[model samples]
Target: MQVTHAELVTSAVSPNQYPQDEIIEIALAGRSNVGKSSFINKMINRKGLARTSGQPGKTQTLNFYNINHQFRFVDVPGYGYARVAKTQRASWGKMIEKYLSQRENLQLVFLLMDFRHPPTELDIAMKEFVEELDIPYGIILTKSDKIKKSQWTRHLSLFKKDLDLPSVDALFPFSAESGEGSDLIWEIISDMIEA
Candidate 1:
C-alpha cells in the first residue's frame, strides 16, 4: 500500500488510552536494537518516523503511528536490554504483554530479528505469546545486508528448523539499507490488512 501520509498519533501506556477507532493495527515486536524502529521507518518510507537508536532499549513506550490516515503501526518497546533496572524492565514487559493480549484491533504482528543471529530468548517468548492468542504474525529478518547472499538460505533454514514454526513464508529477509524484501513485506501487510 502506498502510504501517502503517516503521522505519529499518540504514545499509549495502556490499552484504554489507545485511539478510539476501529482501524486495524500491525505490531512490530522484537528485542532491543533488533531494528524494529528502523524497519517501520523503512516500510513507511519515512526517515526517523520511528526513531532508530544506536543504543539498545531506547524506545520505552507503545508508540502509535497512523498510516495513510487509515491504519496503525504500533511499535512496542524493545525487550532484552540489560542496562535498565530489573524492575523497570519488568514493568515494560508487563506493558507490552498487556498490549498484545488485550488490544482487539491488533491484526498482525511483525516479529523482527537480526539476520546475522538466531532468534533470541525474548523472540521465542513473543512467538509463544502470539501463538497463545492465535494471532497471525510474520517474521522479518532485518539487516539482511549485513550477511552474505549465500548464507541467507542456510540461515533461513536454521531459523525455520529450530523455531519449528508453521509453514515458513512468514520469515523474510529484509534490509533497510538495500530495500531488499521490502516490497514482499508490503504485499504480506496488504493481505493482512485486507484479511
Candidate 2:
C-alpha cells in the first residue's frame, strides 16, 4: 500500500467516542515500548505521525488512524509496565478488552513482540485472550534490527515454542530502522482490507 495520505482521525477511550463509520480496522497490541508506534510509522512511511516515545505506556487511548481513508489502524495502550498504577492498568486492560472483544468493525490484530525476547507472561495472556475471543491475529517480531541476524532464528524459535505456535507462517519480522517486512506487512493488510 503506497500511503499518500494518513491522518489521526481520533483518540478515543470508549465505544461512543469511536468514529461512527463502517470502515474496517486493524489493531496493534503489544507490551509497553514494544515498537507499536514505530511499526505504524514504518507501515505508512511516516516518521513521527504515531509519536514514538522512549517511555512505556505513553499511549493511553485508542488511537484511530485513517489510512488513506480505507481502514483505521487502532493503537491500543501498551500493557505490563510496572510503573503504572494498578488502578490505571486495570482501567486500561478493561478498555483494551472492550475494544478487542466488542468492536464489530475490527478485522485483524497484529500482536507485536520484541524480537530479542520470547513472549512474556502478559503477551501469552494476550495471545490466549484473543484466541479465546476468536479474533484473527498475526504475530510481529519487532525490533529485528536490534539483534544479530544469526540470532533471528533462535529468537523466533523461542517465541514459537513459548507461544506454542506450530509453525512460523503467522509471524512477521519487522524492523522500523531498516524498513524490513514493511512491504509484506502492508501486502497482508491490503489483502485483508480488500477481502
Tens digit of lDDT per residue, candidate 1, span 1-195?
A: 788999889998887779998999999989898998888888888998888888999888899999987679999988899998999899999999898988889999988889899888778878888999999888999999999998888899888876777556779999999789999988887877777
Local accuracy of candidate 2 as per-residue lDDT tens digits, 1-195: 789889999999999999998999999999998999999998888998999998898999999999998999999999999999999999999999999999999999999999888789999999999999998999999999999999888888888899989888788999999999888888888899878
Tell me the lDDT of candidate 2. Answer: 0.93
The C-alpha stretches of model 1 lying farther than 4 A from their native spots are none
What C-alpha RMSD separates each model from the true structure? 1.1, 0.8
**Positional deviation of 88 in candidate 1, in angstroms?**
0.8
Query: How many clashing residue pairs, candidate 1?
Result: 0
lDDT of 2 at 168: 84
Worst 10 residues of 1 by lDDT: 161-170
